[model samples]
Target: MPTVPPTPSPEVITYTVRAGDALAKIAAQFGTTVEEIVEANEIEDANRIEVGQVLVIPQGAEIPILCPILWPLTMAPTRC
Candidate 1:
């Protein structure tokens, strides 16, 4: 019998609140909806988040951010 490979777990991202960041915008940036973030964070109200709050961005389903390379030209075409 052949062994099967296990699926990888989703990764979580975090974002800090800026001076003018709203829940809707934050969700949009993560390709999700504000309601989803609220539900994930157990926020009772969607409009009551405070500034400088460190919210756990539920980007489990979204693509990860690629780090900037010091030598962009050295990167493979497929990676670029």
Candidate 2:
């Protein structure tokens, strides 16, 4: 049997860039990171985003926040 790669989850969100918008701010609003956005969009320059540019925000890509109380219970970390 031929093996097939699993499709990525359709959890991406589209965001249009507005005037004075920066990757850092967008990432914060979407609970993601600038690095993830840059990687997802193949951005050549982090400092050079234009207005009205469409960006794909990958959901659940941010590093999870580890809870001290739950640290010993499971390997999975909870969202911050």
Candidate 3:
């Protein structure tokens, strides 16, 4: 039998919490959701993030593209 390589892992984005950083702001900045951040980090409190704390932000879905594939009939979403 031949040895096969492992599958590729999903891209991970890490963010360090700042003094004025909030989950909602962070989520909006990263195009993700606060719920996702909480879930990913298993956060007990949404407003308990500390300064310099690193967080794993999950970004899986591709941004919608808004390029027109066909006129009138179809509209392709453009990546933001």
Candidate 4:
């Protein structure tokens, strides 16, 4: 049986930079890593964010919730 993969969530949030804000600090506050934020916003310098700069905070990749009733018996169980 062929199994269909789950689609990624499109949810994202925006954050405004405040005084003394850093990539690391902002990442920590949002429960995400600095690298993820940088990749999402295409930031050239992780240390160069300015006050009032709007940042796209990519929430952690969500684990797809599987419903057994929706899946076929021949399909393997999802790791999630």
Best by TM-score: 1
**Candidate 4: stretches off by over 4 Å:** 1-10, 61-80
Best by lDDT: 2
Name the regions of candidate 1 deviating beyond 4 angstroms.
Answer: 63-80
Query: Judged by lDDT against the true structure, how good is candidate 2?
Result: 0.84
TM-score of 1: 0.65
Pairs of residues clashing in candidate 2 = none
Per-residue error at 67 for model 3, in Å?
22
| Candidate 1 Cα deviation (angstroms), residue 19 | 1.3
- lDDT of residue 12 for candidate 4: 71
lDDT, candidate 2, 1-80, per-residue tens:
99999997766578899998999998987788899999999999999999999998876755334455754577776654
Ranking by lDDT: 2, 3, 4, 1
Who is ahead in TM-score, 1 or 4? 1
Error of 4 at 55 (Å): 0.3
Better of 1 and 3 by TM-score: 1
Position 38, candidate 2: lDDT? 98
Global lDDT of each candidate: 0.79, 0.84, 0.82, 0.82
| Candidate 4 lDDT by residue in tens digits, 1-80 | 99999998777788899998999988877778899999999999998999999999886634334445645555666553
